[model samples]
Target: MPTARESLLNAALMALAQLPWSGVRMVDVASAAGVSRQTLYNEFGSKDGLARGLARREADTYLHGVDRLLAERTGAADRLVAIAEWTVGEARAKPLLRALLTGCWSERLPVPRPARRGAVLSKAPAQRRADAGLPSPADLVAAVRDRSLAALEKGSRPSRTKEESAELAHRSEQAVRLALSYVIAPVGEGVGPLVRTAVGGAVGTTVSATVSATSPTAADRRRLQSPV
Candidate 1:
């Protein structure tokens, strides 16, 4: 069963499907969630808080899916290809996700104009003030890229040096950015092959160089073989 917060967030998303964000009312969301307006306010504080909560939930959903894909697939190339395909497919299915990822809102989405002074003064975390508005496109892109880098690092063979790990992470970030570019504005060509080739080539070259430079000790081999 959904908690009060989750229920309210779901109600907001359901409202968004039919109404623009600016037009969505807290009263309506509360009613839809089978909660009182006061409960909604107590849970989310303000409309901005509600929006941020919804965005964070959606981001977690997408990232969790990416994590699952990474675990199921073997090889860096295959995993990268799967992630690209999943992103494109999810973007097509969820308008909100697409808007968040590409920073391109359609007519269906409410136009998020600048907030008024009083609106900005609402009781929310000072650090979350920026999130009170729609997240910047760059911020969204960077968040996804960071997740990609982390996933790549987790799957990579243990690096002998920090520099090697950083290089691998950099390559992963680049591949994610490239994939996102296609997601934002497709070029009428398959992105899977392109991303796979680029990521696979980079990983192969990096691992080969690392291996040639220094062989893994017996302990290192055992650690690599151990289940994570």
Candidate 2:
């Protein structure tokens, strides 16, 4: 069973599906959630607060899913590819999530803003968190990049130095940005190959650099050059 706040948020999403934000009424949302108008206002502070709450949940849910996917016991490149594909699929399904990730909120969607500088903060912790500024598209991309980098780092070899870690972060961002590109201007093909190319190429480059630097006196320089 959902809590009152959850119920209200769910109700608002349903309302949003059928009507534009301008068309959605507080009373209707409260009624749909089996609550009074006062309860709605109490829970969210206002309709704009509710919008922020909704956007917060959307971002939270998406990031949580990305974390879950990244937790799989897969190679870094495979994991990045998996996350990218999943992100594309999820963005296509959820309008709010698509808007949150891409920063392309349509007129029908609630393009929520943070609480004003001097506005009274909400008493509820959740509401307060929502009132805090939401992530921009760049913020979200950097977040996903960092999350991917962290996950990949955990499963990395012990021999990986700080330079390798930095390279890993760069590769992670490339994979993330490639995923974002698919979300923005998708072609017919899936995102897997492209993400793999980004991350996989980075892996080879790191290996080749590590080998060449470590084995200057090696007889087979061609083998040290590495392959994708």
Candidate 3:
């Protein structure tokens, strides 16, 4: 079962899917989660803080799923394709994720334009370097990767070599961006086939080739795998 905090956060995110962030009050989330206003504030501090945490959690979940797909025993190419397909498919399925990506709720709320941008660009230096650079994307990714590796050890392949990590990370990032774009932009079914093909090529080259063809320079591989 989810903790009280987790339940509140999920309820808040689900409400966000239905209403613009500007209009999404803490009370709404509290009501949805069967909690009180003080409880929400106590747990999240402020509306912006709650929003930030929710967005980060969602992005982390998506990338974690990609990590799992990449760890499967399939060939690198097949694994790459699987990751792309799963990403795009999930983007199609999760209305809340799409809403969060596009700031769809903004239309209904009075939020300033900048906050919407911040939500989408969660990895910007400003957001990533919060708290005077106390913690970084490297820290978050390491924690997530460690957990993912422990899960993969159950049946999937162990961690990859430096080259493989670079390849997978490059491809995974592109796949994530493409999925976000598709979710927000809403290209029609007519364009879906073309988009898929283009994204497939893009993801394959951006990530797979980096790992499969030649080992990148030690420095470059380290940078790519660092997740910063």
- Where does the lowest 10-residue lDDT sum fall in candidate 2? 207-216
**The best candidate in terms of TM-score:** 2
Q: Candidate 3 — which residues are off by over 4 angstroms?
A: 95-228
Q: List the residue pairs that clash in candidate 1.
A: none
In model 3, state the lDDT of residue 111.
Answer: 28
Tens digit of per-residue lDDT, candidate 2, span 5-118: 999999999999999999999999999999999999998998899999999998989899889988864666677788889899999888998888888989999989778899
Task: State which candidate has the highest lDDT.
Answer: 2
Which pairs of residues collide in model 3?
20-105, 171-207
| Model 3 lDDT tens row, 181-225 | 655676665333343354344344432344445555655656788
Tens digits of per-residue lDDT, candidate 1, 1-228, equal 998878898999999988878889999999999999998887666786777677666766887888888779766556767787788878878887887787787776644444455654434453145344655666655665666666656745574456555555555565666767877787888677677666544445443254334334434666888999
The alpha-carbon deviation from the true structure for residue 82 of candidate 3, after best TM-score superposition, in angstroms, is 1.2
As for TM-score, the candidate ahead, 1 or 2, is 2
Q: What C-alpha lDDT does candidate 2 achieve relative to the native structure?
A: 0.82
Report the C-alpha displacement of residue 124, candidate 3, in angstroms.
22
TM-score of the candidate numbered 2? 0.86
TM-score of each: 0.70, 0.86, 0.53
Error of 1 at 140 (Å): 4.2
